[model samples]
Target: MRRAIILFVSLGLALGACDDTGATGTVDAVADVSADVSADVSADAVDTVASDAEVTGDTDAPSDTSAPADAAADSVAPVDTGPPPSCPEEAVTVYLYEDGNGASNSWYDQPLGSDDLPLSGEAVSITRPDGGVTAARDCGPGRYGFLDLPAGAYLLDVAVDGETTSHNLGRRLPRAVADGAVKLVAFGDSVPAYGPAPWFPEQLETLLAPFVTVTLSNVAIPGSQSSEWLPGGSNYVNRLAPHLADADVVVFSLGGNDLMNLASDFEVLGVEDALALLDDLDAAIVAIEANLLTIYGAVRAAAPDADVVWLVYPNYAMSDRWAQYLGDYQELAATLLASKLEGIRERMGDVAGLTLADMYGSLDKPALDAFLWDELHLNVAGHRYYAEEVFMTLGGVLVGPPTSRGVHRSIGFRP
Candidate 1:
C-alpha cells in the first residue's frame, strides 16, 4: 500500500435542501413568453437567475408580449438574460493514506509489503494565490475538502508529526459534478465504526474521491453481532434496506463479536472443562455461519446491482492471554474461529459481486500492539490499516508517489 496525497472540498452546508429546478429563458428578445429555458443551464446559473429575480421585481411569470414596445424593450436590463453563470470558487477533495500493507505470521509481511497508515488529526493548510492561507485538520480518516475555494493557483501543506509536506495545486481545481457522485453504504459492527474520526468507510471515501464523487452512509451500529443483521434481523433487511437498495457499493465487518461473546461462556472453565464444552462452541460457530449467509443473501436481494465487500476479523493477538485464563484451550478456540471464517469465505466465493476482505491474515502478532485497541476492537491505527486494505481490495488505485511496499496483492475474490 502507498500513502496518499489527496485533496477535498468541504461544501459548507448540507446539500439536502438544494433546489434541482433550473433557470429558464432564451437569448432572443422576441422569444415566446411561455417558452421554457434551455436545459443546459447549470445549478449555479439557476441560483444566480433566482437571486437576480428577487433583486428585480419580476416575481410573476414572464411579462406580457402584448405590452407596449418601449416598456418591453426597456425591461431587458431588469430581466438581464445573460450567459451561463460561473462559480467564483472550485471544490477540491483530498485523501491521505499510510504506506504499509497489513499481514501476520507470514514472512511475506515484510516492510516492503506494508501500507502507510493514515495520519489522523494532522494539520492541513491551503495557501491561495493572493498569499492567504486557510488551515483545517484532516477529518474522517485522512479526508479534507475546501468548498467554494477562490479560483486560482494554490499550495497545500500537510503536517505529519513535526514535518510538513507540501504540494502545489497548479492553476485548476477539480469541480463537483451535479450527478457524478457514487453512493456507498457500510453495515455491521464496531470495528468499522471504531471511533468518531478515522473510520475505514470514511477513509475509503476520501481515497475514491479523486476518481469519482462519493456520498457514504454508515449504518453500522456499535456492539452489533452477525445475528442482528440476518434475514429476519433488525438492522440488515429493515433499518438499512433503503440505503442498500440505492448503494453502488456496500462494505461490512462482523463475526468477531459473536465469537468473543461465545468465548466468554467458557472462560471460567479449566482446560478439561473447556474441552468438554467444544460441542457448544461448535454449535455457536454453525449458527454464526448460517446467519452470515442469511445476511449475505439479504444484502444481495436488496442491493442487486451493488458490490458487496466482507471484512474478516483479524487474528486475535491476545489469544495466548485468553488461553492462560481459560486453562490453555487457546489453540482450539482459535482454530474453530479460523474455520468459521474460512467456511464463510468459501461460501462468499460462490456469490457473484461479493468479495471477502481477509483481514485475519493481513496483520501479524508483532503488528498487533500498534493496531489492536483490545483483543477484539481495532485502535485508530488499526482502523486506518483496515481502510487502506479495503480501498485496495475494492480496486481503488493510490494516486500519489509510490513507496517500496512491494507489489500489493488484492485481497478477496473479485468476480
Candidate 2:
C-alpha cells in the first residue's frame, strides 16, 4: 500500500494545486523533497475542466483519491456529439531539456522531456498532419517553431548531439484549426509508435484515407509508463492534452512498458521476495487504472465530440523474458503474471462506456506468434492487424472506417 501511496501523494501534492502557476510551484516543492515525495507531476497538466477554454488540475477528478472516485463514476455521461464546430487554428512549439525531473516533474514522469536547461540550436523536423513535412528553426532559448506553417498537430523529431528523439512536442497555438478534416491525435507508449516504419496510427490513417481526409499526429514515447500519462503526469501536460482541443478521433496504446518494468523487476528479486513483487504488481495496476480514469475524464472534458479508441494489449505470454533469470521459479512467475492479465481484461470489459478495442482477444494465435516483434512489441505485420480490427469496430459518431474492405487483407501501409 505504501508503494501506491508514494504515487498518490506525489500526484496529489504536485498537481492538486491551483492554476498554471500554482501547478509549477507545486512541482518545485515536490522537487525539494525527494523521490519519495515526487514520483511524477506535470505542471502543465489538465485535470478538471470547468470549460473548454480553461483546464485545471482536479484533485478530485481521478480515482486515486477516495472522495472523488464515486462521484466521477456516478456523473459519467455517454459519448455523443454533433457535427464538428469551427475551432480556432493551433500551432505547436517544441522544447528540449538536458535532463528531465527537475521542478516540474520527476524522471519517472518525463523520461525524455524534463530538464533544467532550455535547449536551442538543435535541428527539428516536423511532419504535418496531412503527410507534408516542415523544418523547425530555433526561435529563442529553449523554443523552436516552423515559420509560415498552418495550425495543426504534427509529429516532431529532435536531434540532440547524435541521438534522435521523436514526439508530438509542444502545445497547440490557436491560430487556425483544420477545416473539414478529421483531427486524429494519439499519444501513448511504443506499441503503436515503435518504428523505422509507419506507426499503427499512421497505418490507421492510410486505411482511413479512402473514407475521409484524416489529420494525424502521434507522440508515442518508447519507454514511458502509464503513471506518467495521468491527469497530472508529464505526458498529459507536455505531450497529450495540448493537442486535444481540436481532436475528432483520439487513440491510446500504453501499459506494455509498465508490464515490461514488472517483468524486469522479477529478474532481480529472490524467491523469498516473490510476495513483495506481487504486491508491486497490484500497486502498479492501481496507478494505471487511476491514471486511465482521470485521462478519460480529461479527454471527454477537453474534446467532448472526439471518438476515443482504447487500444488494449496483445498477448504478453509470447514473451517469457520475465522468468529468463529465475532458475527454479520461472513457471511460478509466468503463471502469476498470466493470471493477473486475464483479470485485467475482464475488468476492462465490464467498465461502462469505455470504448475498448480488445486486441488481445481478437488476435489470431498464428499472428500473435508471427507478429510478436521483439517479444513484447509489435512489428509492421502487427500494426496492420491492429488497424484492420480497430477499423471494423469504429462505429464512432465522429468517424468510421471504410466498410467495403470488411475483414479482408491489409492493403499495405504507405512507404
Candidate 3:
C-alpha cells in the first residue's frame, strides 16, 4: 500500500506540472519561434537604421567647399569682344602726312576718330583680297565722303600715284584698347606716303574706323635711310618732332634707301674698305638710331605719352637682284644684318612703349609684285598691302602711349 501511494503522488506531481505549464501560456512551437525571430529582427532593424544615418551624414558632410574650388578657376579669363565693328559714317578728323616738298607732294591720308573714311572720288574704292576693284569717287579733300553704311568690317582701297592700297576698315580692333584717345603717327619712306593705286593712309583710315581717335601723320621721306635719321641731317627730325610729341602712337618704315645707297657705295669701295665704311656706317646708324630715340624722347617730352614702333624695310628678296646680292653676302652680310637689326633693337629696347615690326618676313611674291610701281618705290597697290600687313600684324605689338614725359629734345642729335 505504501508503494502504491508513492507512485500515485509522483504521477499527480507530473500531471500538475504539465497542467501548470499549459495554463501559464497557450504555448505553440511556431509562435515561440516567431517571437524569438521578431526580437532578433527588431535588434537588427535598430542597427540598420543607425548605419543608414551614418552613411547619409558622411555623404553630406564635405559638400560645402565644392563651389569655392570652381569659383576660383573662373576668375582668370580675359574679356572677349564678340564681333569687331565695320566703318562708321560720321564727320571724322583725318590727318594726312605726305612725303616730299615741292612737286613730289604725294598725299598719304589716314582718317582719325571713330568714323568711316570718305570714298567719293576716283581716289577711293573697295578691293577684295584676291585683287579686284570697285570704282568709287574722290570724296574731295579732307572729308571721309561715305554715308549710310553698316557698322561691321570692310576693306577700303584708295589709289595714289596709280597704285592701290587696301586698308582694313573696322569700328575697332579686336585687341584691348590702351587708352582713350590713342594717336597713331605713320612714317616711312615713299611707300607709306604713296601707294601705287589706292593711297594707303585713306584706306587705313577706313579700316581703323569706330575704334579709336586715329591720328595718323606720315613723316616719310623719299630718300631717307637708317643712316639719314641724324638729328638735323634729314628733314625727318624737324617733320617728325612735333608729330611725335603729340602722337600716342608712331610708326616708322625706313632703311631701304640706306641699303640701296650703301649697295652702290659698297660696290665702289670694295669689301676691304666696305668694312671700314661699315664701321663708320655703323656709327652713322648709331647716330640715326640715337636720333630716333631722341625724337621719341622729344615726342614723350611733348606728348608725355606715346607708343613708338619701327617698321623695318619690307622684304627686298622679291627683287631678283636683291636676292643675288643677299647670296654674295655669305656669312658676313648675315652677321652684319643681324648685328644691325640687333643693335637697333637693343638701343630702342628701353623706350617706354616700343615695338619693332618685322616687315622683312611678311613679303610674298604676289604682294611684292603689287608693291613695285618701280624697282624701289611702292605702287598704290604696294602701299595698300603694306598698310594691311602693318594694321594686321603690328597693331597688337605696340604698348599704346607713354605714361611719363621725357625731358630731352631731338634738336641736339648730332654725330
Candidates' C-alpha lDDT? 0.44, 0.46, 0.37
Per-residue alpha-carbon lDDT of candidate 3 for residues 283-313, written as tens digits (9 for 90 to 100): 6566666666765555456555444456654
Which order, best to worst by lDDT?
2, 1, 3
> Which residue segments of model 1 deviate by more than 4 Å?
1-179, 266-272, 318-340, 399-415
Q: Which is the winner by lDDT between candidate 1 and candidate 2?
A: 2
By TM-score, the best candidate is: 1
Worst 10-residue lDDT window for candidate 3 reads 405-414
- Provide TM-scores for the models: 0.51, 0.50, 0.44
**lDDT tens digits, residue span 1-415, model 1:** 0000000000001011121222111112112321232222111111110111111111221232122222211111101111112221324334444433422111111122225444456565655434456674333555555555533333344444321111111111112111355677888888778543567788777655655568989988877789888766667656678687677777888766675565454432232343334455457767877787778788878767565777766545223323333233333234334444445544444444455555644443333333444445554444555665565444322221221110122111111
Q: Where's the lowest-lDDT run of ten residues in candidate 1?
A: 1-10
In candidate 2, what are the lDDT values of residues 120-229, reduced to their tens digit? Answer: 67776655446555676665665665554442233444455421111112112111222336778878887778732556788778756644577888887878777778
Better of 2 and 3 by TM-score: 2
lDDT against true structure, model 3 = 0.37
Scored against the true structure, residue 187 in model 1 reaches a CA lDDT of 84
